[model samples]
Target chain A: MLTNRSEVVVKKEMSLLERIYIPAILAGMRITLSHFFKRKATVNYPEVKRPFSPVYRGQHVLKRDEAGAERCTACGLCAVACPAEAITMVASERKKGEENLYREEKYASIYEINMLRCIFCGLCEDACPKEAIFLTDRIVPSTFKRGEFIYGKDKLVEKVDKRVDISKRQTQTVLEFKQNKKFAHNRLYTDKQLKEKH
Target chain B: MLAFLIYKLILVVAVFAVSLVVAMYSTYAERKIAAFLQDRLGPNRAGPFGILQPLADGVKMFMKEEIIPGTSNKWLFILGPSLAMFTACMTGVVIPWGGTLTIGDQQYPMQITDINIGILYLLGVVSIGVYGIMIGGWASNNKYSLLGAIRASSQMISYELAMGLAIIALVMHTGTLSLRDIAAMQTGWHWNIVYQPLGFLIFIVCAFAETNRAPFDLPECETELVGGYHTEYSSMKLGFYLFAEYINMFISSAVISTLYFGGYNMPFVGRFVHDPNVLAVLGSVFLFAKLFFFIFFFMWVRWTLPRFRYDQLMNLGWKILIPLALFNIALTGVLMYLGGRLH
Candidate 1:
């Protein structure tokens, strides 16, 4: 009973056709010849990068407002929600002439994420109420030492000329903020839309 | 007479060079075919599409250190691969590459020698190929090498009988042993294969065995015999053993096409052109086309079929192929005697 219950077993007497062996050989040759002309399965990597999906959670991005000011309010909600305790920041008050630098008067002075500890679960992005932090499609590059993986504001902040591309962002609130929210930061897309007549 | 001798010398050198070059490329072709069969890109790094790969391989072989085992007969160890390569190259001298090359006013045959007993000379050369394996294996002082050599010699000898019998059937129809005459006789669509299909089948199967190609490749079966007879050989010496096999394959393809498929004779050359030189060149091209197809088929069957067990190899050679060949000869004789002669 144990042997019978093991797995599906097939047994049959050798037919005259199988004994001759030519037909079976011809069938195998046919399969190989078919593969010869079929498209190869190898992907030529490095030169041709495969795109990630919209729902992929990757490196976190600290967003900005219309005045090119910092968005992180140093509310500590994200740090509290982090499962890995990856995010850390020092709060600072916005000075007299820093309206263009900070959207909120109270903004984060120093923000860092220990990428090695971050599980990249998008929990922090979901937990933030200020819409200052969200996950983007940029993957973390490998480093030689564990210390290099702790990304600071200089490494995490998007450059002015090359801001974070939000095409792959699938979060519903982020999408709603882009289309309806008056103060939502979308300098790249809204300017193009205004010029296009759409 | 001196001019004729000089012409023959040139023909010999040209034929030898052409055979060696073709055999070199056959290795590259074999690798490419194997890769494609499994859907992968073969060597395309050395030069454009790896055309220079064979040259690179030859250089690598020469650069490698030579090794002769301490317990081996050094002289015989050296003689083995040399003899194998020599015998393989010798078979190409009789095959008519083209009809004739006319220069100024003198007409010269493109073949190295038009020996009266051409087919007999070929069979004799092919038979000597066994000694190469035997000597190499015996001198190596390794059990695996000796076993491979024995397998090779026995396989070659057993297959040669069937091969000769198959040829005898074709000889009865043509009434000549000269390959040139046999090829000339089968001028049009009346190739010997049409008359002796069964004979061609037996001969082809035996050819596979004689050349040590797969399905019948028991001599150097890697799983059993490691590197076979050339296990102790290294550097260019090892290259000769492997290269000789490819040369044997090239010559075998040429000989097969010459005997059964009308060597140097196109289907409709006479209808289209009358210039003798032009016809000869075109005929040579046609012959090469046939040769290339046979070589590809050899590799195709190699990749397709599994190697036979040692006992199975002997059974197929003696029990099956020999009887089939004998029957073919008897049938050919009966038809020739009863009916009018077939072209």
Candidate 2:
């Protein structure tokens, strides 16, 4: 329990030199002088990026199959799994000719996920039996209006191939970009694309 | 007239450049000092030993947007830091950096100005230093700013008394208020610190309070006032406040050296350096070393000591320093009179 009583602890007496101002001043100076020679912790921003954890959450991207078909089958499972109720799907019958493209007999025709409401939990991917959705390592771009965050199939499709070979090449390029010049001047990704992935 | 004007221009430019450079380095030094005190490495990456950190900081400050609050007195808010920086830079004019240097047949003193009452001029300049803080705090129009200003003004005023009293005692012993005369008097092994130990101690303590250094740094108490007078300041205006602080530190160190540590005089430097030019250069180097020591001392104290409360600070100034200073003055006067009579 908390008490109003003050506890008193007796401290040891200071030496004669410590009592005087000069010695204490000298001791402090010694400390400062040592620090004067030590290394600094500042990372030169734009030029040098600090190492980020592998598990770091960034922008999100939807996955694609080997044949470049979107993994999502508009089953409304993601919509049900979404805690924020951000995902919405409109099912349409898969035509006889389009059976190879979509895994489900009924695929989502008007699928929209409100990026503002979506929690980036990968639960939509987990819920799907076809493994049709995955959150890729990307950041959502900040926006002024709530309407801009409603991501459709056009925005959610993986534009770039995430194959191992392509990822390796991209990683090297990103590393080189960080080293060769300031990050602000590097324009590998457009603002719109960054926003879509995010 | 043209030649005289050119000479004055050169002197002003030289002093301004030196003070600016010294003040910039002092910031880096303060950071490094604090880091070391806490058993941490300071800035070492900007350049070797973080020498270029100040330059980086200056560039960063310049690049930042100048923010002016809509409700503030824009004119006075702008005026405050500028005034602080200007006064701090101006104080370097009267300080004798070294003895006279002879080139061809002409002799030029290292100091910019050698007015008859140079010491008094320094005191006057230091007294006006308070106006900068006062104006800044008042102009900020914040309650914390106003309170800080009030504390700073009163603190400076209180300490100035003890400081003035200490200087008076020194003046009595030297029989002149001229800094050059006082410097010349302390020849060979006879530095004023030996004769006026008590006066030096009082003056040093008052100097700490005057500069608003740690243990006496009540004005900008971060816990209480959140950056004090410069809370609302941004960009180069904020830079000016920070820059002015270092310049004040440099000037205070220089003043301490001049009054107590014998300015630029070295025990046997005159014998080794026969040429006036060599002597002047050597004297300036020695003066710089001494000044550096005092600056380091200031930084050391800043990191070591905890700040005093408002009431405690007032009590120490009024109840302790003033009385001790008064007694020391009377004692010095009586001793000087008796010695003269005996002679």
Candidate 3:
């Protein structure tokens, strides 16, 4: 059984200075004053760019072969890979005498990808056997129209020859076909000749 | 007479320009101070650490479309912020910024207007500032706005009593109503705050309530009122309301400095600066420094404390402030009488 206790424990009284308003106000002022001297966290935009991740998705670019020919071989793999169902490709057969221009027998004559529909997934690159398409490090420029985003072959293709030259000593494996200068003559064939042979 | 009128006109324009500019910069200062407290950089992109931010803000305000509510009284809606801004600007007139600066034969007082009943004039002007809030709230035709107006009016009235009582104690001690004369009385070590510390506390709290600053900012409570009184106002009209708030802040700071902190009088400043003209300028600078300190204090408190609830604010003003002010007054009277200080 517990008995009730009447005695109360006395707490320390507030000081006269503490009870007065000035000290409390001064304390609050001190906190604000300290903050006023601290460094500002604002990053000056435009002049200072924020760090972007390595896998950041930006503009799309179509890859090219060493001979500067477009790598896309009329393959509709990109259209299937897009999650957004944004990619649309129109493939056509390579014209007569266009074998040197096109890598594959069947080339995309009117290859136009609707960029508006493209989800910018690297899955398209994974799906392509030829490794034709890729997203560049550069971000896509902002535009107003949906129609302007439909990228044609002219807009997607690499404008410059971006191949890096290797030293002759660094070439570990020399192909047997390049041993004879006569093999180079046979390699330069017209689209008709190559198609007929195939 | 024409030249004198032209000069007075110039002075009025000068004071208005200076006060408006100061208020605008004070907003920037408040933001910078808040950012500094929170360990973040404030605006610094507009022009050289965002010095032209006020200009940009002014341009933005001007460019914005003014919206008037269909059900609201348009005339009173316009009148509200105008009145607020007007009352705020008008209070600066009585503040004695510096003593007389004599150049050759002419001596000019560094004050806009010095009436005999200067302290009472300030009190009356400050009291009228409530009307702007009340009118804005009423005209907004919003339940929240009306509630805010009602709260603001009641709170202002309650605090005014304590504030008035505190002023009375100061007046009793000083035996003068003119601010210039009151300032003159506290020449060296005899500042009003030294004699009336209790009165100063009451007055400062009442000043906070009167200005609708935290923890007494129940009128424009964002959580409850959704912008409170001027909810319906937009464009430059809304800008006017914001501008008026900063101006009111500046005026309140000036009033506090003038009343308790010896206006512009600096201790032993006279000994170093022999020239009256230099002393006058220095005095004005001292007054500005004191005002700036109070302004920073206001911003500091705003960031630190949450606002008081309506009933809590009322209780603070009526139950605590008023009674305490009365007691302080009684105490001052007894002390002065016993000490034979009062003539």
Candidate 4:
């Protein structure tokens, strides 16, 4: 009664051939035979993978600076913004001799993200003021142990030699904003600006 | 006489092995064909195109925990599947697979035994096959199993009538009870299917019901009765029941091929091949081709058609097929009479 799509049931008596059901069965068989020749819908999952969208959010990654230093200043903004509350970290001041490793004075010492709890919403990527955390397209490989799923900085951090390309993640406006060094939040200070600050 | 006995022994073992192998592969083919029809790749992991799937299934079936309910009649439960498997394997003996092989002026027919009343033997064995389901169902002490058994027995009894009548129509034309003679008569494009088209139609439909295949598979219908007759059966016992169904399918296909189509007769090839041995081998291959096509047809129909409702099944069996088969017999008699008068 919601719509006019429903048909009334008719009680018309069938003719002799129709009552027999051979012609109808033969017609049904013809349809199935045609489908036997048609292209199969299955994609062999392991050997062949279907393409994913460029911005498809999956596993999380911690970005490294140009000089091979950790970009995270232990701001805790990503952790606060995560709806799942999957992120947790401990802040530690950088030592005098560890300047090459740490981009900022304050950095995360123990960063852990429980992958089982993380909903892959890309909210953490949006909330990262330092542009340190990102949701990359690389899938999280399954493991038997629950403990193995809690990804540490070792698994999350990108290697210095092997950089994960995240150019597609940012929009034109965000890329344009990075060029303007007027904002301190950009974290792209010139050498003169550093000296002036000192 | 001793040499003939040895040859017969060897032939018996070969036929048994062939039927077993065919039944095993039928399961694999059913899955693969179903996948193809649904536009999906099925079971390609076990081996190249999943050829070793049946072997894996066999091992799994053997390794499964055998369960017999405490209330069940244990001896009859054991007897049920064994009887089913026995009856399934019994039908292949009488089929004339190939022509005679002449060895030093001695002829060796490519069949285990050419029983004169082969069709009757087949019908008798097929009727006995219902006992396996009935005993299993009744012995299980489950209401569903009993219902399934009742349905199966009734279905088989109803359909066998039509199937026999259909065969009677064919037999009237050939005037022989022996399968070898029937196969031999259909030489040079003179297949019985050409004459007995309507009879073949009825026979094929009844064959579907007889084998307990889809559209006629109400005995083990999953929707209403959970696992049906073999509800309480487990492990290799259950495997035996399932395996028996496939074997029945293979045998029915062979029967259909032998009776309707030219069983082992390849047209024009016999003229080219002068040697008897080579001809016999070629004949066996041709017969096997027909058997495989019919098996494929069984699987094809299984996937295409939905299972019939219980009352619809009974109605079709009793009302439609029986009357049609009777009409065919009368028509065959009249036609044969007219042809003789004309001659």
Candidate 5:
């Protein structure tokens, strides 16, 4: 009565052939046999992986500058932005002769993100002012220990020789916004700029 | 005489080994086929294409913790799977695997035994297989197990009538009960299927039921019975039950091939391969090829169709199959009488 798609139920007797059910069974067998040769829908994981979108947020990575200096300035904005409260760190003053290791005067002496609690929302990537934290497409491999999932700088930091590409996460608009000089607070003032100002 | 006895012993061992090997691979094939039908890769780990999966499964079964229920009848519980395995392995004895292998000055039959009532013996062994399930279920002291066992026994009893009637039709035409004689009679394209197609159809349907396979596998129906009769069984005891089912499938396939599909007989092969020994080997290969096809057919039907309702299963077995089988026997009898008159 509502859609005109519903048909009336019939209680008619089946013919001899229909009653036997052999024909219908044969037809069904034919359908399944065809599917036996059809391409499988799932790939072998670990050995084969499907392509991911550029903006796909998976594991976190701590980025490095061109000079291979750690770019984080011990800011707590990412930790505050993380809804899961999975991030924790201790700030320490960068000592002399450690400029190559720490880009800023204050750096995170100990940084840890409990991967087990992090929901992979990419908020940390969004909250990073120095562009030092990024969510990459690489999956966090599973481990037995809970402590292992609490990723320290050793696990989260990008290697000097092997870099993770997060250029795709930076949209054209974001790139253009970064280029604008009107946002002076967004600019990172280097030692040369400080010297010139003094 | 001693040589003859030794030869017989070797034949027995060979048959037993071959059945066990085929049963093992049948388990692997069942999983692979189930996966393929559903558009998925099944068990490609462990070894190449999961060829070693059965071995791994056997190991896993052995390593599992064995538990015998404290409240259950220990002797009968132990006997349950043993009886199931025993009957499953016993059914292959009379199946004619090939033509007689001719040695230097001696001739040897490929089958273990060719009793005059070979078909009767098969029926007896298969019917006795129900006791295994019944005893197991009764011994388990579980309601679900009891229900499953009851269903299994009733289903087997219902289907055996139609199966017997179907085979009776085949026997009427062939005029012998010995499987070897029946198989030998179908040499060079005179396959029984040509004469008894309806009988073949009935036989196959009944075979599916007797083996407790899908659509007819109500005994171990997982949805309702909670692992059915083997719910209380664990470890290799459970493994034995599962393994016995596969062995039964293999034996049924062999029986189907022998009865209707021309066991070990390839048309016009005798013309080219004159050597008796070579012919025997070729015939054995042909029989095995047929057996594999039937085994595949069993799995194919399983994946293709959903399980039948209990009432519907009974209706088909008793109301439909029995009458049809009777009609087949009557038809065969009429044809035989007419042929005799003409001769």
Candidate 6:
């Protein structure tokens, strides 16, 4: 406590209006009346979704290649990088005539993300050697079962022709980050940059 | 005689149902208004715009486990909320909701009763309000409950003196105790408020105190009194107390509107409307508008002001409000005497 803090003396005298209290009450009522018409701060969740930032980390998505094949080569960088130890996958050799199913020689036979354990930090997205994993703006749906929370490949992976919605992720922060810009600008350098950075 | 009896029954039921519904919605509106004041939306889930929220709340209250504390007066505890609610709902009879509605050859008024001693009846009912709090607190067998009850009874008694004085000033000016007659006299917006502004002010302050609203909500002040008079109460018994408060507020608003704001009489509205039934309906609407506004004002003050300390509350009620009421009465008497001589 500061010793220099002066103890202010009380002023007991109140003006006629202060004694009446009606005028002061009217003034306060005016303030509250103004707020009644002002825009409400409620989001009305479920029906109306509030826009999240582009960098907003959420549900995990396993992506596909341009040729409609699994992009993950099971390099284990994402699993190793995951702080929560939420991701697990079993790798298998892509057999003959399986080029349509998998891009690389090696492919993930089983991939599961324990959503309860998963923090959605986007670390796995950054650690993916094959650019197969991403944390989309998709909110993790609440579930009653712990088993249901451990999302399998069917839940995590994008469909063959379907595209991930990244509209919210294209916010001002992404525009300022040159790397986010180069994701659309250059694929060759992005791979090289990731490899060199890793 | 049969027709009159039937009409009275209908009017009484209509008034009772309307007051209960208004009280129910007041709970919802209070929350919404409070939310808006704090820049938030309150209860928009149960139904469209949360209109069914009160129904849901009623259901919840009814479903809750009813508790009666051991070593307490069980009958008095049961009777507490019932008395509070009974006294609350009982005040609606004398209020002039609207002028007479003439159906065919018959003329029936919108009020349940046009009791000549209407104002006196209101004051009597208001006095009886103290019993509910006292009984509930006493029966609870708790110190905090007892304190709350004492606060409630004392506050009611102190404020009632000023309130009665204020009403007397108005009675002198209007020269009638019949609420309907007083309202009819203040036709075309020639309101009693213009004549007795000071009296109106005192009355409004007393209204707040009598309703046990904020600044004087010492009885149910959650922080200090725990649950106050209703501390040991649960389920519908607790609901009844809360419900009674809102009903009291509605009745007070009606009384204030009738006494000061020309009741159901609207500004220049009488000139344009001549049909008796239509006019009566419109008057009822205008009365409701005034009631709603005054109710909103009650909630507005609740959120804006802090609770008063016991000593400060006592000082204001006894020292200031009492003298102000007396002075207002003297001023009104002088004005009425002068006006009569000039005429």
lDDT of 6 by residue, B1-343 (tens): 9988988999889989999999999999999999989899999999998999999999999999999999889999999999999999999999989988888888888889999999999999989988998899999999999999999999999999999999998898888899999999988858988888888989999999999999789998899999788888899999999999999999999999999999988887768888878888999999999999999999988988899999999999999999988998888878778788211
Model 3: per-residue Cα lDDT at residue A21: 53
Q: Give the candidate number with the greatest DockQ.
A: 5
In candidate 2 the C-alpha lDDT for residue B64 amounts to 99
Q: In candidate 5, what are the lDDT values of residues A1-198, reduced to their tens digit?
A: 887899999999999899878899999999999999999997898899889998999999999899999999889888999999999999999999999998999999898999999999988877788888999999899999998999999999999999988888888887565456336566688547988999
- Reference-based TM-score, model 3: 0.82
lDDT of 3 by residue, A92-117 (tens): 77788776677777767666666666
The 10-residue segment of model 5 chain B with minimum total lDDT is B334-343
**TM-scores of all candidate predictions against the true structure:** 0.75, 0.71, 0.82, 0.92, 0.92, 0.85
RMSD of candidates 1 onward, in order: 8.3, 11.3, 9.9, 5.6, 5.7, 5.5
DockQ score of candidate 1? 0.37
> Which lDDT values do the candidates have, in the order given?
0.88, 0.80, 0.81, 0.92, 0.92, 0.89
Each model's total of backbone clashes? 0, 9, 8, 0, 0, 1
User: TM-score of the candidate numbered 4?
Assistant: 0.92
Off by over 4 Å in 4: A1-11, A171-198, B341-343
Q: List the residue pairs that clash in candidate 1.
A: none
Q: What is the interface RMSD of each candidate, in Å?
A: 1.5, 3.8, 2.0, 0.6, 0.4, 1.0
User: How would you class the docking of model 1?
Assistant: acceptable
- Docking quality (DockQ) for each candidate: 0.37, 0.20, 0.42, 0.68, 0.75, 0.58
Error at A74, model 3, angstroms: 3.9
Minimal lDDT window, size 10, model 3 chain A: A164-173
lDDT of candidate 3 over B240-294, digit per residue (tens) = 8788888988988988888899888889988888988899889889989999999
Better of 1 and 5 by TM-score: 5
lDDT of 4 at A40: 92
Candidate 1 per-residue lDDT, tens place, A68-183, comes to 78788898888999999999999999999998888888988899999999999988876777777888877999989999999999987776666776655645777675456444
The residue-by-residue lDDT of candidate 6 on A92-183, one tens digit each, is: 99999999989999999999999999988877776665668888877898988899999888988888768786546545664455346435
